[model samples]
Target: MEESQEEIKRGLKDVAACETRISHVDPKGQLYYAGYNTDVLVGRVSFAEAVYLTWFDNLPSQKELSDFESSIISEMNLPEAVIKRLKSYSNSNHPMDILQSEIPYLGMHDPDLGDNSDSANRKKAIRIVAKVPTIIANLNRIRNNEPLIPPDDKLDFASNFLYMFLGKYPDELERETINKYMYLHLDHGLAASTFVARSTVSTQSDIYSGITSALGSLKGKFHGGANERVRGMLNEIKNIEDIEAYIQGRLDVKKRIMGFGHRIYQADDPRTKHLRELCENLCRRANKLDLYEKSKEIEFVVLNKKNIRPNVDFYAATILDALGIPVTFSTAFFASGRVAGWIAHIIEELNQRIIMRPTSRYTGKYGREFISIDKR
Candidate 1:
């Protein structure tokens, strides 16, 4: 039945589109993938293993994990043609714009471009996953006038991203840090980007197109850019003393204090716990605990003053900053993790073979008789 506008749920809040075995963000705000708790999976399972779990709904044994990593590394080396094309993009373009625009062209370079078979899509998924980090890293390198670095076959997914972006291997701890970041965000329950990706694939579009759709969805400030905004907020704070001033100032003006709330998590975002710890440790290691100190003050003040909890982006901003990632690329780096979820959802949508079309409540004027130009 067609319902009135008031009956419609804005943003599809509390709506369930389909059942998924891939992952769950339960009512209590706990996150799990393939029945394994996220806390257990992250730091314990490789990002590659996590990807395998998303695809197969089971953890990969060591042998399967090795094979998956091998497949991804072999696909990591982008074609020289793609490299030349990437070099031609204007340095002034936003990294997400460059990333979104490059994906379709990258799809053209794929051998399985039009093949929508499950096996073929999985192959394309692997390639897309492998190349996204490269695309993100190289695009920024071009912008900075730095020579693009190729992927390292010896490194795993996270380490290679650091290598490609930073032009050297991070230490094991640093490498593991990036890996954990990637794994922790591998899949979530039907986020906007995942929905966009799934909807694009429901039309029989290729994996690249699906991911391109997701990148566009993620480019929005609300969905994926919070971490970048958090970094900006931290920068604006400048010192620990300014934390309360900034928070109260925003509150006074009825402006959102970014990273303090979530649509899904009731109190605190589950991901915030690890990222908070990681951010503090990194700050301590670098002897640059000012940002961490400022962030804690902000969180404390916001919670007491507003009763709002900090989401993942709150601490993640400091964590990524502590690890030396530029604020410009923070969201794109977010896309790097989110792409795994996008792929998983795309695969699920295609397998289910349901085209997603929702009804809308139109409130435009009722139909009237049309008049010709010569009507009196």
Candidate 2:
């Protein structure tokens, strides 16, 4: 059957790719994971607890939380061979590429690499989520020519990443802010990277391979990498005076502002409020509160002129910047939280067992004349 123009979805916007119990994004812009509103989950539960709930569809009790945290901490260190390979890449590759390639290789060390059973896949999921941060941090450290900092098992996940980044355990408030960033980004419906991960695992491939696909998808400018662009925009508008001119110039050229809008969000991103507060708090502590103030001015101008509000990444860029994370590594920081979502979707798709192979409309001419080599 021939399809009408109206029937085609250019980017699968508003399309339901598959049924999922993992997370839901309501039209009101609120996000829910397995039946719990994410807004409620942030301060109420630890990031590990939230991640466990995403994978298992229920909150963990005291014993389960202890065991889950222990399991995750146990997987934080890379295999010795992987560590040696990582040290080799400290020269040139982008952090995202380094991470994307190394994670798939982690499957090589997994005892359950050949097993597609639910139980085996679950273990693989935990390993991927926990180890990705170490991979991201080490790749970033080596890229900066800094000595690698070992992961501290005593600290929680976010604080340990803090130690890796800043070479010290951050203050309690800073740790809490990092945890919030991780929790809010843990999952949000079936985002592009999650879709890619799910599609790869639908072929019954190993979880590590699926995550590699997800990482590649996220490397695109429009997905997880947008946060880096957001950071760039923030850098470009260094002074409060430049924001209006900056936004105006981009608007005059019809340039798409990277972080001002979202496909699923209606009015405002529900995730931004907490992040905005956290961004402000961190900037104040760093005594770089101008970054937050400048951001607010940009938001006011963009909202008035374009009627578009900032998305999660807009404020997140400032928070990350305040934490001393560079623009280059922002996307990798995003991936640390997003890995949990990818794992959740991969697990759900495998359970349902439906391959996500969407059909496309062919627009090219169907027939053509063939010419022999001597026809010319």
CA lDDT, every prediction? 0.83, 0.85
lDDT of 1 by residue, 1-376 (tens): 3535656888999988876888888657689998988977668877888889898888888899889988887787777888888888776667888888888988999989988999998899889999899888887677778988877777887788888887777887778778888887787888888887888888777788889999999877777877789888888887788778888999999998887877787756778788878778888888878778888888899999999888767887887888887888888888888888888888888888878887878776665779998994
Q: Count the backbone clashes (under 3 Å) in each candidate.
A: 0, 0
**RMSD of each predicted structure:** 2.0, 1.8
| Alpha-carbon TM-score of each model against the true structure | 0.95, 0.95
Candidate 1 local lDDT, residue 156:
86
Off by over 4 Å in 1: 1-6, 373-376
Between which residue pairs do clashes occur in model 1? none
- What are the per-residue Cα lDDT tens digits for candidate 2 across 1-376? 4543446787898788889898998868788989998888877787888898988899999999889988887888888888888889745568888888888688898888899899998888878887899887777777777988887778887778778877777788888988899988888887888888889988877788888998899878778788899888988887899888889999999997777888888867889888999988899999999989998998899999999988877888889999998778888888999899888888888888777777766765645788898995
Candidate 2 at 238: error in angstroms? 2.5
Top candidate by lDDT:
2
